[model samples]
Target: MRKATFIIPAIVIVMAIIMSSVFIVDERQRALVLRFGDIRSEIEEPGLNFRIPIIEQIVLYDSRIQSLDTAPIEVTPSDDRRLVVDAFARYRIIDTRQFRLAVGNGGLREADRLLEDILNPQIRAVLGADGVTSNTILSSDRAELMQRITAQARVLAEPLGLDVLDVRLKQTALPLQNLEATFARMRAEREREATDERARGEEAAQRVRAQADRTVVELVSDSAREAEIIRGEADAERNRIFAEAFGQDPDFFEFYRSMTAYERALTGENSSMVLSPDSAFFDFFAQPGGRAPAAVPAPVE
Candidate 1:
């Protein structure tokens, strides 16, 4: 009888423990309580929660930040250049009820896939309104584009209860098919500009050098002309002074110059001369009177 009583109490205690088991919900979770494998249609906040064991289940949801990485998208520019654009998004569950009804727990992945299709076209549409090509847009306009991508994605996702916080472009570049052609064009343009700039610099340097050379020629020619004039003037001044000195005794100067000429012309080792005793040279050699010159006056007795 005592054994039967112990067995009955043990059974009751085990059933109570099973029925009273509770789940702890942290600060970042929102959950749905499922009754008999069906959602109870009410969402619960974070706290200690109880449910019937073996008959009910807790479906937890992430209420904090979450991320979705999208596949690379292909976009064309105003100039028809193609590029590959990779994007990502930051989102959080804002309205649990709508999220559950619209996406369900299993539907988030499918929703993300849907988001990719929706956001890319929006990106293309906005980008098509721009003046730049895909390559330029990819290079310099990434920040503006990222904001646009997020804004467009938010518009598409906000109605579905997933609040898209931000969208970002992870990578952007020309499509592999167009990579070589685009890069070659860019390189050629840069090289052509460099060539033009170098040509301009060389031309300027040549002009400056030419100007310096012309100035040097002009200066040298002017100096030579001035020196010639000064030399000519000095010669004329010397001739005038000599003429004035010779006027002091004209006949003596004439005789003295003639004697110097005779000495120079006749005394040289390679010289020969012929002269008459009565030649004009005799006029100077004769005595002061009209008489013929006497023999050298016998030792000046």
Candidate 2:
């Protein structure tokens, strides 16, 4: 009975010591052995690790890529244009020993705080370099700007055991006051363009109207000249026909003219004319026996 008790207690004590000495190193993490707060060994591979149970301590840190979302910060570029910038970065703990020594047991949280401090100053410095404008930040050069920021931040992050893989600008915008001013300027420019277009349209319309007016004047003048020419030709033709008819019968022409003159003298009911009895105009009326007037002799040419 005494041997059984001693052997059972010894086995139980050995099992407890073995369990306390052995630690697990996960694939996603790296383990560091610290003896009295001094780093002694670094376990990078995932496997079983041994440490003095009561004297040595282990601190585990994630080895995977991590992200840091910084707060929105104001940056002024070379053009003196102030902008609000929100940025993020992807980084990983490259050196576990340096990370623990520099950041302590604060882990990812401490690294994030330190990264923000390093990132913000460099953002202001590189973005504010000569000839880097706000347009450049919002345009095709935006990728270049982020590259510069990442490269600069990587150098500063080396001592902190961080490798800055990439830096990206999430949002870049002007302040509310500047936005309103830009809108006003854009509105003014559009209004000016519209005004110029309207003026050009009106000028073109005026030119068209002037051309139409000139065409109308020329057309009317041509029509009036053609009508006058036609009238003159018709009058000459009628007179020539009358001359031929008169040449055929001289006495008949005289009688026809006397009758036409008598009709005119007695045109209307209220028309009256006083004339001498011997007047040649009364020849038709005085001849009651239908006597004809003497024929006029043709003059020799």
Candidate 3:
């Protein structure tokens, strides 16, 4: 019974030691052995790993790509235009040993802080470079600018054991204080364009109206001239007819003219005229044939 108790206790102690010494490194992670606060070995492959108990410690870091979002930062382009820029980056710990050494016990969180420090300045530098304008950052050329920033960040991040795979601008916009001013300027420009268009339309309409008025005046003048020509022709025809009638018979024509004059002068009940009985105008009424009476020869002197 005494030997049985000692054997069981030894087996239990051995199991405890084995469990503490052995670790399984997953495919998605990298493992590093630390001895006395210093890196001893880095395990890059996935498999069973062993370390001395109590004297060595294992630290695992995710080997997959990670993302880091930076805070919104203000940048001024070469044109002196101020913009608020938000950016993000994709990175991975390429060298686990170097990463562990650089970050110590802070792990991924500390690495993020170091990467932000590397990335923000490059964003500012590339975006604010001599030829890079705010217009360029807001355009498709922004892709090229991002590439430049990524290249610069990768170089600076090498010592941090980080490989900056890509950097992208999430949002690029004018600052809050500049928005209203920009909008006002845009509105003024549109209003000016609208006013110009309206002026052009009014000018065209005036031209059309002037053309129509001229046409109307020409048409009315032509009509009036035509009417005057027709009236003159008709009056000449009437006078020709009267001349032909007078040539046909002088006595009848004279009698007809005298009757017409009498009818006109005697028309209406209110018409009145005072005249001597010997007046030639009353000769038609005094004689049956409308002929004037022959006066007797004056007495011989």
All models: lDDT?
0.74, 0.87, 0.89
- Across 1-301, the per-residue lDDT of candidate 2 in tens digits comes to 9999999999999999999999999999998999999999999999998999889999999999999999998889999989989899999999999999889978899999999999999888878889999999889888998999999999999999889999999999887778988889999999999999999999999999999999999999999999999988997897797688789985677777666666665777898788666555665567763544544223222
C-alpha TM-score for every candidate: 0.74, 0.77, 0.81
Please give the distance, in angstroms, between residue 97's alpha carbon in candidate 3 and its true position after superposition.
1.3
Segments in model 3 whose C-alpha atoms lie over 4 Å from true places: 241-301
Supply the global lDDT for candidate 1. 0.74
**In candidate 3, what are the lDDT values of residues 21-86, reduced to their tens digit?**
999999999998989878889999999989999999998999999999999999999999899999
Give the range of the ten consecutive residues with the poorest summed lDDT in model 2: 292-301
Q: Model 2, which residues run further than 4 Å from truth? A: 1-13, 230-301
List residue ranges in candidate 1 displaced over 4 A. Answer: 1-21, 105-108, 130-142, 249-301
Q: Kindly provide the TM-score of model 1 when superposed on the true structure, using C-alpha atoms.
A: 0.74
In TM-score terms, candidate 2 sits at 0.77
After superposition on all C-alphas, the RMSD of every candidate to the true structure, in Å, is: 7.3, 5.4, 6.6
Q: Relative to the unseen true structure, what is the C-alpha lDDT of residue 298 in candidate 1, on a scale of 0 to 100?
A: 14
Whole-structure CA lDDT of model 2:
0.87
Error of 2 at 14 (Å): 3.3
